[model samples]
Target: MRIVILCGGESSERDVSLASGGAVARALLERGHEVVLVDPAAETPVLAGPLHFGDVVDEFAVGKEPPSGLGRRLLQERMEGALTAGPVLGLLRDADLVFLALHGGWGEDGRLQERLREEGIRFTGADSTACTAAWHKGRGQAALGAAGLPVAERAQWQPGIEGVPQAVRLLLAAGPVVTKPVADGSSVSVHRVDSLAELERVAAETGSGGVELLVEPYLPGREFTVAVVGDRALPVVEIELSSPLFDYTAKYQTEGVSEVCPARIPADFASRLQELALRAHEALGFGAHAYSRTDFRCDAAGEPMCLEVNALPGLTATSLLPLAASGAGWTYGELIERIVDLAMS
Candidate 1:
């Protein structure tokens, strides 16, 4: 199969996406598949051969802070015809399956998926509707809550939106609240606020930038993630963060975080987590063969609460989806092939 791996869009997660794309391209190549790497945001859409994880890893290492000015750059690129450039569309139409290694921005937020569907191109991961449903944290949480799945109390605030801050303040009254972009991944711009002053500052920053914010009661318990491939939920992976929050640095860098696969928890508890993950996936309208990763953190009562569902989770060597797959007895190459098979089917 000739697979085109799309990555490195004009998002804050561009570097992370490049790392994921390099890893996926290598794995697919090792399996004897014809792989073409494309960075839709690049001046030259088609990437050269000999993709290496180390190349991207060293060049675009995720730092302690998320990349800034990407939101504006994304808007600028779109206006300049980034994803819809003739070269990118031509490559997509020629592929048997387009593996989306994209993380945030238009790539994972349903815009790119919608374009692919309109062009009649097959791609891995969820379709446009499911991607849109899952990309927005508030929307996905609502769907999960409607499915009777446990979710942390959350509120959304946009510029000039009245009454949202009041609701967030109520949540803050209970405990510290976390503020993050309403529609983003890789924990970009995620901040933990302990007081009204800090919340106001963060809210003001987002408001000035015209970005919507989602506020939720901060859960400080054990962090775990479950990846669902096809119809089954893979083993849970526990994330031990050295920092207070699992920010971009803790996620991509090797220092501040450690992941324990098949998390050392009671069988029943792990089973419940997996069940909730699958339910969340289905509630968001994901296809039977589509894959997604659901993140959870234990609340004050020690019960896991759904955070968000990732329609196109990262595929880097350090990514939780591949780690969970390893716990389920699947090699990285096998996992990549399985996703390809599912997409082709």
Candidate 2:
């Protein structure tokens, strides 16, 4: 199969996406498939750099890492722009499938998926409607709640909306609250606030960025995530982080964090987590073989509260999806092959 693995879009997760695309392209090549890795943000998308899939892995293995502090800010500034898709669409014309190794922002927010559908291109991951429904946290949570799935109470902030601060304060009055952009992934800009002053500061900081925000009472408990592919859940993975929050660094950098695959919990609890994950997937309108990672927080009563679902979960060497896949007895190469097979079928 001739595959164009799309990655490195203008999102905060661009570095992680590039890593995932490199790994996927290498794995598919090992499987004897022709792979073209493209980054939509590149000025010359077809020739951004040498496709050196394995070489990229070697570089990371040698400690070429994600940018930090000022460097991180500069890279993020460059990635905040929209994607230019002309060159990528041209590459897709000769491809059997465009494996979506991209994450967060527009890549997972349905715009790219909509464009692909318009061009009649087949791609891995969810359809545009499913992607849109899942990317917007408010809509996804409502759909899950309507389906009788347990969802944490959340309030959304819209531009030009009055009383935004008051609403957030009310939410925080219940307890510590988690505030994040409504449509971002990788836990970008996710903040936990325990006081009215903290809520005020977080709201001001988040609002200054001009994206809609969602505030929910922080569910205090163990954090676990389940990866779903084709209506079934892979093993659950518990995320333990020394940081106050599992932000982007903990996810890709894998520092100050530990993950337990096939989480050491009761069998019944694990089963329930899987069931809820699948239920949330369907309730959010994802179709068959829609690869996603659903996060949860087990409350005092042991009930799993749905955090949010990543319709396009990270597939990086350190990503939770691949970790869960390994626990299910699927090698990384096999997982990539399965995703492609499902999309092509």
Best by TM-score: 1
Per-residue CA lDDT of candidate 1, range 194-217, in tens?
A: 998888787887655678889999
Worst 10 residues of 2 by lDDT: 55-64
Question: Model 2: C-alpha RMSD to truth?
Answer: 3.5
lDDT by residue (tens digit), candidate 2, 1-345: 778888876776767787788778778877877777777666545433334334332222312333323344443444343233344556776678889987876688898888788878889999888899889999989988899999987888764455556677688777888888898787777888898777667777666646788988877688999999887799999998787678766766666699999999999999999999999888887888678889998776777899888889988788899899999999999999889877877
Candidate 2 stretches with Cα past 4 Å from truth are 47-86, 159-161
**lDDT value, candidate 2, whole model:** 0.78
Give the poorly placed runs of model 1, Cα more than 4 Å off.
50-60, 70-82, 159-164
| Per-model root-mean-square deviation over C-alphas | 2.6, 3.5
Q: Where does candidate 1 clash, by residue pair? A: none
